[model samples]
Target: MSEHRQLPAAPPLPDPPPRPKKRQPTQDEITKARLKFLKEMSKHYITNEENIVAKEMFRLHKYNWPQILVVTAGCEGESDFVTFSSDEVLRVDREFNYQCVLARDRVGRIISIPLDFDIKCRVVSHDKASEKQFIANIIESHSLPVTVKFAVPDNHIFDLGESAHRADSFGCMALLKVYDETYLISNPLIDGVLDPHIIIIPLYLEMLISTVVGAEAMSVKEWEEYTEEVKKDAAKLDFSSVKGRKAMAIYPDIPDEAQDTDIYSYIRPDSYVILREKETGRIPKERINYCEIYKCDKDENVYEEITPSVPPRAPQKKPCSSKSAGPPIPKRDKSSTSTKLPPARSDVSDLTVAELGEKLKLLKLDKYVKKFEKEGIDGSILVEMDQLILKKEFHFKEFEAIKLTKFVQSGHIPS
Candidate 1:
């Protein structure tokens, strides 16, 4: 009643304004996410002058702390940078969190660096743009000096410059060859955008690297020596058993009768020959037969006969099957490396089952080993068959093509 008068009915408590209908956002499509990121980064660097503000923005964007990892691209002769092994780089996510620093180059190779260690770098343009006005703005904002200027001569048409003119193109970077990719980081109209891959190198690091390279320049003499050394190594034959000054000699294995007929048997003094002699100019008169195959050269003190299995002019046998039990292997006569001793099948009588299997492996008849066991051909009978083949005096070639085939099929040597 106190002057209330219904308070004008409280102005009828104005009806609450109709709630605005929530908007269904129209989505923004990103055709090239890489391009978008590159644009944003370029713009950000061009606009932001303060490092603190820029770095804070970087943090807001959830970017990792900057780092550097020097990687070797190709072997020494192929690449311009100092040729180092690629193994120097640690594997990504291999006990360390890291990612590629830049986009792939024209070659589509991207390099990654670890966040655990901080390495300095220099950011220099690949001499892409030369327009003074265009570069002045970039230098003012980003503080990166244009190391190279992309040239378009007056006679050349600008049409061909389109690819190189892209916002993110393969421009030469000072420290690393980075692939040029622009990722879509943010769109005002889109949600759930990816973070941009940003690679920025510091100035000091580039200078440091340049200095180091300048100091390590290769001299002409050093280069020549390296070339000669490589050529020498390329010309020499490589053998495992014959190392250093030691050599392997393959004599003609000529029968005394063939000595006159075979061209290889024509002896020349004062020249190298497989047969040992007192001196290089000397030759055995009539193939002197003795306990030692090497000629007695006590004065010259050349190769001393170490193994009894060797002939004076025998070719050294290479260690077979990548394994050897004792001293040098006993030499066998054959035209090829695949030859194995054809002990009389009866000789297997003395060998155990293990020894028999090993011998079969050396002969490259391993496929028949299990077959022997499957057919219940014990060591004794196996040895007997082997002796029969040996008694026939069939060398490796005859054994492989004829005797071994029958042995594998029938599980016994034919009488």
Candidate 2:
């Protein structure tokens, strides 16, 4: 019998379908209210480098992977990595598996690549050194030509066991180090730790990883230029000054690490609170009142008293409500076929119990709106009220009041 002959054939691989073009909203498609609200909130950390990471990542990646849902901060232990939305591994071939990549910058190189299945990705740094050095080491190990260095002052002083820095102390800035290679070099530790809560850019780095890194490594010159451009872009940022004065201040009580919940929440939009020894520099999620903020400047501090509930604009005496200002609709004869219209209640304060009930029937507050309504009891009188509790100290009596204030400011409501 002839010996069996086998032909060596290449293994087959699954080709993922072509990705759809990302849907961009037209000017008409955008909800103006939502866009405006987002713009207001983004003013807090828009220029933060870490915060910009998420936007950069999405711009570089997510458009091609529609099924991938990006959650900014993971909710639980299970929330680590770019796991499949369905929580199942997608097999591309025998050696390659679908995975989430975390891309970010350390010193200078755009650290973009998929983490291996065997390796558990994490962030770590010594009490005396910046995390940037550790990240830079990882990049250098990848055969990428990025130089890394850490500066150690004569003595690096950190408040013992706390995240607050000693106010007005150059000792805090001593930990800042410089890292450079043929491709990228500079410092990212400017006064505060580049942690997750203060900056959501790591999420962006995750997105960029799938875009910039591949089988063909980037050239050192290209990498250097890219980092230089990023540095130039950052240099243009002017967050260290408030009205031309330097932002740093020293309060005798503000330790190198402070845990004032109110101050944490307030400064969060501008920078993150890095409580020493805490896993992440995030404020405790519990609802903390504004009074807890111990030491803060007026510009950087957030307090409760600033937000107040608005009252109904001194009951606008409308022409329709004023008896002498308008012609009233003719009253219908009792036996006539025409429908009789109920009279509007212009004076709620002077209304009788029966009349108040009749007027309240016309003012229908929806179930959601009723959540804010308070029924005040002053014996034999029903005082129906609606309020918006803005801060611990501020409460608005009605939505109408809020609207009226804006209207007046914008000239929509006559003074």
Candidate 3:
């Protein structure tokens, strides 16, 4: 008869390393964390004023970097004030590549962790480039044809509202279009008054706030209902949140239908609605005092109290490659008689983030490709990218698929 005696209980596992207490983030810490985010965005694109912000960010992130070298407009009123409204502040510099919005990912990985992606301008590369020298060179050497990518169908970039500002959502909003100079008029009437008939005024929603006719008084219950309706309508997106505008851009409407193609499918109605200070227009700086960041890597998840200092700086690039001639650019295959090479593989599961980005760029699948980059050095992101590219929503560049497959097999990725 088999005795059903349980073996002695295994020795209790060793206690885990003590977790450091969570603390507030300092102003300096916030700036550095933001700078790291900006640097990541720079890899995909370069926009105006981005250099200046980068310089300022670099200064704050490092103690040794002298403040004298990095300068800004000295006076508050005279200068741009470096508000959320800075112009040409940064550009992504890639074709069909643009910034996507922030939202909680399926892995419980929200952009807010480790740093409030809200204020830091959390941008990442979204698409592949076309007609570039490097891409051309790769195709030429491999006897592969350079294939055109699927262009993101241009939806009319939505207009920005007068109330729209970075502070409204802690700079987490998706970018809308520029409205300053474009909307400005040269009437030369800044200090002068003119005939009301000649004003050419159009009906505007903001005008209602000043209108007596629309301001009819209502009962208390009616007021509550009215306020609720306003809140509801405010959420029904006036635009497709893009790379640069300020709308807290976190709560992007990624409906089930869009679930297949949209990269920001993680955001939903119930996601924690923080940083969205609807009452005050901007998140108070004091909130940084309570900020705590949880950074996870393959080895461990590090939670740090930020007010005193920030988490360790992002991993430095491999030092050995610092001065190496760097990876060789594959030579063009001039021997091939065919003008077109081959297409990227339909199966992208085996590719790394860098490699998958190349495939997306070849096919022009930037946003979906970039959604992974936003996840930061995660292998899981690679899997997510693979599933996305296979869907019908992505327009694959079949012409370049096989060529890309061979090129990737040849082992060369731009450093």
Candidate 4:
């Protein structure tokens, strides 16, 4: 038995070479991939006579072929496919899942091209800290470098150093200005927790374009031009409809005679306005019986009121019933006739500090009345203060501040 000199243990295998880091695809490579995908897709779906038209469109829009690809990537053709007539050169459909642009040749043979793209988002932030945290969370959660834009509501004090001119209600419209996308992210916070997600962009523009242009099919150039025009129109302030029409104030305490006027119209008592005339100057002195109505604008300043053309009417009195003569009527003093009437239900701007405390008692918020008095927050100041001011300066809790702010903003305190 050759004492086999134990063969020296085979040299330990060297550790496998560290795998090379996968190189990220560049923009050019990504675009190429997308184009290749779209070309293969066209070849698979398009056939016979329609295939010729598809190839021509691809050739004609070679510089912007990506646009065509996005517009017709995931489409399935069927007789039941919903079609919308465009004035330009293409017909479109409303179904987001099956969204497509249809092109027709002289004989009216139809080719459907699907439009699909990654949905990007624009977030509205009230402050820089919140915006930073929001973006950080989105990046961490998705593990992708998602492109995000930030918008601050008109008059919002964003610490991010960017001035935003867009209103919160039009945030979606601002997002639409970016034409290269499909879906939108909305309601970032769910149940008081930040949870951002995507929502389909409504085919509202397509429908509007179809209605306005009334075309059977639109050329690519025409489609782009019309889409841009529609987007611009959607973003503007439209006051033409209500310009000369009579408008009603949202507040109930406004005198019935003064409530409806041809000056300003609001959608809600607290925040929204439907139509407003540009301020010219102070209300004319000739309008004797005028009440100043304050409105918050995008600039954070209040709008001056326009005097109602109608004169304020004297309060009507109820006639006493002869059947119910309860007590012997006492002679009334004549001098009291000149006394001023009590303030309207919504008018508390004339109340004293102590009177304001009494008003708070009605809302079960009297605990903070002392704080208000201590801060010299009188009726005039109190009416102008918002929740942020109350919470920051008066040290009120979130709910407490919100309740009080709403009470003041509504301009109506409970009896």
**Most accurate candidate by lDDT:** 4
Question: TM-score of model 4 relative to the true fold?
Answer: 0.18
lDDT of 3 by residue, 211-323 (tens): 01111244457534533543343344332222221222223344556543223322221112223232322223432111111111111111111121112222222211111
Residue lDDT tens for model 4, 212-289:
222224455754564464344333533222111111112223334763321111211211122211122112222101
True lDDT of residue 150, candidate 2? 25
lDDT of 1 by residue, 222-309 (tens): 4345335433433342221211101111222334475331122122111111222211212223321110122111111121223333
User: Quick one: ranking by lDDT, best first?
Assistant: 4, 1, 3, 2
- Model 4 residue runs over 4 Å out of place are 1-346, 412-415
lDDT of 4 at 359: 77
List where candidate 2 sits over 4 angstroms from the true fold.
Answer: 1-224, 236-385, 388-401, 404-415
Off by over 4 Å in 1: 1-227, 232-262, 265-359, 362-378, 385-388, 391-415
Model 3 CA deviation exceeding 4 Å by range: 1-243, 246-249, 252-254, 258-415
On a 0 to 100 scale, what is the lDDT of residue 26 in model 3?
A: 98
Tens digits of per-residue lDDT, candidate 2, 149-221, equal 3232312211211122322121112112222111001122221111111111222122211222111223557
All candidates: CA RMSD in angstroms?
32.5, 26.5, 31.1, 28.7
lDDT of 3 at 244: 23
Strongest candidate by TM-score: 4
lDDT of 1: 0.27
Clashes of each: 19, 19, 38, 14
lDDT of each: 0.27, 0.25, 0.27, 0.32
